[model samples]
Target: MKNLTKKIRSKKLESKVDLTAMVSVSFLLIVFFMVTIDLAKPKGIGLGLPDKNPEWDGKIVCGMGMGDRLVTILLDDNNKLVSYQGLLSYPNEKPKTLSYDANGIRKELHNKKRLIQEYYGDTSRGPIVIIKPSKKCNYKNLIDILDEMAVAKIDTYSIINDFTPEESQLLAAN
Candidate 1:
């Protein structure tokens, strides 16, 4: 009963936090990262398939050369067009070895383009090309041929990897 006579004291405490500046700093960091990073895009040539046409039914495409004419090109391991021309369904045509200089594939293409314009008329379309890259061909040669294709201004060309028996025999002979 004597403890009931003691007096008691009480104290109060309060705390406050301002989150505006912290949120602003976080938002600024997000924006900075978004602005600084770059996304990578893939690079290379773009190609499409031709609609089924009977004119190409019996033709066997092959060769090595370039220009605004329908030419066939065979890219060998040595990065050379062992044989190139503007017709399919024909025999090897005696595979012509070529250099990468302006006097080689590029020159051949320019000459063929001139001939086509002269004979077929300028109103005629650009040359179509058929590219056959043998299994022994390397990626660099493929790219080089593609670059040649672009430089040759060939509008309709297909990259076919299949090798005909005659082409195989010719390639073996080389």
Candidate 2:
């Protein structure tokens, strides 16, 4: 009779779930994805172009000569580039074929920039570069030369499409 009177005890079960760890893991995944998305964005190069309609008084502002301050870079096909200092007609340095490596066009640009700065005795006044891309060269070549301009930290530069007869012949010869 006493055993029959004893009620059956049920085992206690834990129904509460600890969601703190799950929440932490979710936040960590969100942060990781956010960081990776930001890193996947594309980078761009800043290019500043001159205005087409410029206000000019038809008068020479300064009488200073540009003979020693000019450096011309001609882009050709097959990853070949030709560089010469000063005017093409009367070049201070003859045109020479150069590569895009550290010891090639890059070195030439650094040396020429230094020489021009020393010649003028002014750090603000840097070399004036004229970049001419031939028909044989591709858009990548032009971009590469522009990149070199930025790498060399040149201040004054111009991309002129019109090439004189002598300049055309010079590129062909090289």
Candidate 3:
């Protein structure tokens, strides 16, 4: 007779999940990132600070006279930027307030560059920028000005902390 009760069956179901593919994919992704990504590459403005040579006398010395090519940028509080061509004592151009934007400092730089090239009859010579940050001037302003120098393609720039008496008076007046 057909079995009245179905034969007792014991079925075993495997519930284990295979994670080999997932681990392999994760490993592959890690390797891909390691190969594709640049690691610890330093990125920032390159500054060439002048070395204090024992031979250097206390004078504004360069290949040629810098009086005409000098562009002193004084960073004051409230993001105020004062720039002038030549020395503060006897400026080639009077001190004028300039912004860090394209029309302000950038345009000034470009104009100065063109003027210097024309006057000197040399395309390679650019203005010598002296960046002087006041006591109240924040670090961001300093960085922005430096970035501007880079954007303006200024070759010779000096970040001088020690301001002269005239420069100090100018900043205070501003």
Candidate 4:
């Protein structure tokens, strides 16, 4: 009976040691995760994301690292796509006018489409149009440009804020 009692005591001791090892492992894992975790908030293009219901398709899509195939449309202080160029030549010059003319937009779109087809052989994957409009741009000009985009059938579009956070804050404070 003494031997039986001793054997039971040894089994209990082994179980306790196993529990201690498991606890130690768990603590180490927790510490490792805490130290290596990334907690920085993600920064985006500052546009508000629409609600997640899939039925709402007007949400402006965002993408990073678009190559030379992108097409950029700039709306100046007057809200016009005055300068239409391939992705490489963006920000080179101010776009020309505020007048609402679909003919010019269609022509530029067709030209860009031809260029893409001639160079890369895939005109179906149309260029991604990034519209950078000035804050004071009129609403009518914006609507006209959007209508032109739709007519041109260039669907991937992004409207970016012209000001950085600091500039925006300064403007707001003023």
lDDT of 3 by residue, 1-174 (tens): 887788888999989999999999999999888866755466677433233345666443453256788899999889999999887777887899999899999899989989988987877777889999988899999999988889889889999888888988887887
Q: Judged by lDDT relative to the true structure, which candidate is superior, 1 or 2?
A: 2
Stretches off by above 4 angstroms in model 4 are: 1-67, 77-80, 84-99, 163-174
Model 4 over residues 1-174: C-alpha lDDT tens digits? 346554433444444434888899999999888866744445556332322334446544453223434665555444344444443334323333334565577677766666655765664556667766667667776777788778877767778756445333333333
Give the per-residue Cα lDDT of candidate 4 at 54.
48
Scored by lDDT, the top model is 3
Please give the CA lDDT of all the candidate structures.
0.67, 0.82, 0.83, 0.57
Model 2 agreement with the true structure over 105-124: per-residue lDDT tens digits: 98999998888778767776
Ranking of candidates on lDDT, top first: 3, 2, 1, 4
The total number of steric clashes, by the backbone 3 Å criterion, in model 4 comes to 3
Can you tell me which runs of candidate 2 are displaced by over 4 Å? 1-64
- Could you give the candidate ranking by TM-score, starting with the highest? 2, 3, 1, 4
* Clashing residue pairs in candidate 3 (N, C-alpha, C atoms within 3 angstroms): none
**TM-score between candidate 1 and the true structure:** 0.54
